[model samples]
Target chain A: MATQSFKTYFGRNSRQGLWYVPLLITVVGAVILTVYTDDFASPQNLSNLLSQAMPLIIVAIGQMIVIVIGGMDLSVGAIISLTTALLALDAPAFVLVPAVFAITALIGLVNGYSIVKLNVHPIIATLSVQFIVVGFARILRPVAGGSVPDIVVSCVAGTVFGIPLTVFWAVIVLLLGWKLIHGSRYGLHLFAIGGGVSSGQEDAAHNFGISDQRNVILAYVCSALFAALAGFYIAGRISSGDPGVGETFALDSVTAVAIGGTQLSGGIGSLHGTLFGAILMVLLSNGMNLANLSAFLQGAIKGAILLLVVSLQSRKKMGL
Target chain B: MGAIAANPVLQRAIRVPPAYLVFAVLLITLWVTKPQLMNVNVMGIFIRQVAPLGILVLGQLLVMRVRSIDLSGAGVLLVVNYMISSGIMGDVPAIAYIAMALSVGLAVGLVNGYLVGRRRVSAVIATLAVTVILTGIIQFLASGKPPGDMPGYFNDIYNTKIWIVPTPVAFWLLLTVLMSLFLSRFVFGRFIAAIGENPTASHFSGVPVERTVIASHILASVIASVAALVQSASVAVGSIRLGLEMPIDAVAATILGGVIFGRGDGGVWGPFFGVMCFALLFVVMTSFGVPDPGKQIARGLIILLAAIFYGLSSSEK
Candidate 1:
């Protein structure tokens, strides 16, 4: 019985995916880092790592939402960049914060509408949006300079009852992600839609009365919202808006989602898997930085890791 | 909407590639607005600027026809540029440099093919990852050793003209003609058409689907490398910060030319004019005094509009 249960948990065909594999790798990686480096176990470094990993974890969770429905959003990085730019505009905190979310929602809506109504491919649609958004961001703030609202900064940097705010940030984001991805019927519909897509039956979920189009659109919205949240967090940390700040988040979020044992072909994944995957990426970078590895080499290594991880996951479709 | 789509005249118009129409429109716009700039010498320079992109598009349309993509051109371009300009290759003859660049293209192409065609990985992620790896390596090398000046011969070759047409422009035209002939007159063209129409049906009918896709990728990468050589030659010095816009522009031009993933309705000349559209677009933008950010927005808008055109038409069909 135990063997059967174990097989189901880690099996290739499981809906949970091979998530345990990354979890295992994360554990092994953490142990190795602790043993090898004097600074790895320090509270300061550990906290720093959490803070560094937070934005990615958030963005990956958003990416996971879209990937779950056999779609992608390359515009997330641009959305994040735009968010920071807007926040840094000389405005009141209350006005800037809501304005950011509203703008991102509209962007997501357009992305969803393009994919659903106009029948544009997900990558092409998102890529065009990415360029458009980035153009606007660059126009708004050519370089990174203007200060963010004071309230946003304090929320991210302040401690709560002797615990760092990043810890609270982690708990809240994870809880929300878990609720949206696992605890809701909407999440189930996303899987149904993605399963149909990967299986080459685009209408299977719709046949079941799932309203797949609306769900897919909502998923894109959530993705944009999460990216905006990540942008907000970064704006707080940096205390200023940088037009190019979120340039890498699009690919990084995709890498994180894929590493979490989430199939890029869609239909199978777990929140914990994504969490572990984000942690693994952060861990690898942390260890590499401590070892004095060149930043460029570290980038190449990360790319290799993404390549290796994706190659292992078999898929049905042949194109992007 | 349905009634309009059903009209025979509209249907026929839709079948015609948008590239030709856009090219004509832009040409007329240019002739009317900037009559002085329409001369051969001035026009030749503008067209020559897009020769590298035009060459890259030839490969892009081939792969897209077979339902795959390659975003790794930037990486290949960066590496080739680095090799020639970094002087790390250490005074190699120009021929030797050309051979080395082609070899690098061949290697990257083979890897992309193996992953996309055989392993069935998403072509976007695979090629994008390859680009990231190449970019990282180039950055690392450049950081350790600063980039140096290009050999003067490349610029000389780049500047030469054949009967008032620049050498690069002539070269780009030759490649396009060769590509068009290869696709229309050869068995490989038939294979590409069959595969694009239906991979499974083509495979069952004895077409080597995987081999063809792999070959297409290898050819595309090699073509991109040649474009890179020209691009590197056009510049006076090597820099690590090569624009990533080339591959994306290639995609835009290919789509604007009417060759989308798994469909090659536009054929060679359609995309040829598509490249011409870009050439004219720059002139128009320059005359209008559009800034860099506006140009970026225009690029994005063009791709979106062209894709939507195809998307709407295809869905209607």
Candidate 2:
């Protein structure tokens, strides 16, 4: 049923395949806004849009990996909360900054071990971690008032060649994602582990000596590191460490990746699409804000879009 | 610990549901430290506090038994909560509110069922998205304005007691009993068990897998509305934030009751005690003068422990 629809929709030499669906939607959405609203393509609006996507882009990088690995990390947002809290704590940047990555990586290891070694379901394990970390984040700073060092601010906030400093960071992370997943032989193994595994064949990747467990652990570790970077940048942008910041990154990243055309059930995804997907999501929100839409209404729109993306994407792959 | 758990006698006892053990330990601690809490009347007041959650679990377990999950209870609770507290239906009778809440729940549940059962969307993602949509709708409708007070008529119904038990607690108990009977005596129970054990097998065996799953979701949402009604009444003054955590708590309580995801090994009594354990836990924590943050931490720890225990049990199997 799905194949018939796909062939009809994309035509015979569909090089880009279904990835073009999200790209088309994003372009159409942007085109409508540009024509209807004068300031939609203004310099200020464009810059603001790119900057808004900075932190989310980083978080989505991590989420893309986990989604590819057939697992999820609900604690991603919590890790951001924890990172900012630690960054805001009473300590020098030299001492506290490294602590953020180390601790997040350690937490990621724990998350990975629980899922891989202890055999806990990814959702259950990560959700429990979410509760633990969220409570701790709140407890650490009930009110958001922690100072971010000036040096850290300049590093993440200062611009390069008149563009946002964070955009540079975004580009770097994007390249890294591309290289890791689409370049190296190791990357092919990562995809092999998630993709082409017969259903319920838990160790099918093992037959290829792909080391599924190691790759799963690596996926989580990368997620934590990327989330830490996002938290660091957010703190720098705000000039304060906020426990409340990045609270939506966990689920929103899932939404963004899905919109970018990544399958939630693992395997068959590309970060290239995720990058545009994140931009599209932020653009929609930003566009609505400029339109003077109510925040409440925006929430509804976002949720509805998330549902649509998850369900509609499967129309040809797993047909509803 | 493994050796002890591996013992045949211990295995049978462990299968009795760990909620009892936790309840016993907590109750004993309370007995020694705050014997005043042992009074039946006092216990009734505390039990009333968690009756809503107790009711929600009945639905959660049913959905889980059919190898699906209902995370949309919070969404139903919020919408019903907004309706009653927002006074959108001003000057209406209590039955009107009740009907509206149940209907709202039924609508949401049917959507969830159709999405998961027919469309084959993942249960977690569908239900979660439903919650987000409902939350957004409530937020949009409220428009940053706090909700007004709940009508007094519902509160009166909430307060009414037959004998010493509060009306809400009694309602919860009655529902639990009815659910047990429904699952045990009816053909639906067979469908649930068959589907839960093996969905494909159940389908091949002519168990009407899709219908059973959808029916369970419908039941879950309707019951969640009942829970929401009780919750809104207890507060009297409406708050938008009441039910956000209830679904997660319901899942935790269900797990602690020994009903792992897609399995109903503990039965209703275990979850009954699971809800009791939560009530007692709050009582004990409050008595000990633990602050709200501390209680939140303890709650997280309990959930993590449950997850860890589940891992242990599954790995052992």
Best by TM-score: 1
Q: How far is A136's C-alpha from truth in model 2 (Å)?
A: 0.8
TM-score of chain A by itself in each prediction: 0.97, 0.90
Report the CA-based lDDT of candidate 2 relative to the real structure.
0.81
| Residue pairs with backbone overlap in model 2 | none
Q: In angstroms, how far off is B296's CA in candidate 2?
A: 2.9
Best by lDDT: 1
The digit string of per-residue lDDT tens for model 2 on A141-250 reads 77788787777889887678888776688778889988877778766776666664314456778787788888888888888888998888888878776777877788
Error of 2 at A73 (Å): 1.7
Give lDDT: candidate 1, residue A208.
96
Docking class of 1: medium
Candidate 1 lDDT, tens digit per residue, A1-320?
98787765677577778788779999999899889878877888889999999999999999999998889989999999999999999999999999999999999998898888888999989899899999999999999999999999998997989889999999999999999998899998998999999888999999999998899889999999999999999999999999899998998898889999898988988888999999999998988988899998888889888888889888877866
As a TM-score, model 2 comes out at 0.94
Scored by DockQ, the top model is 1
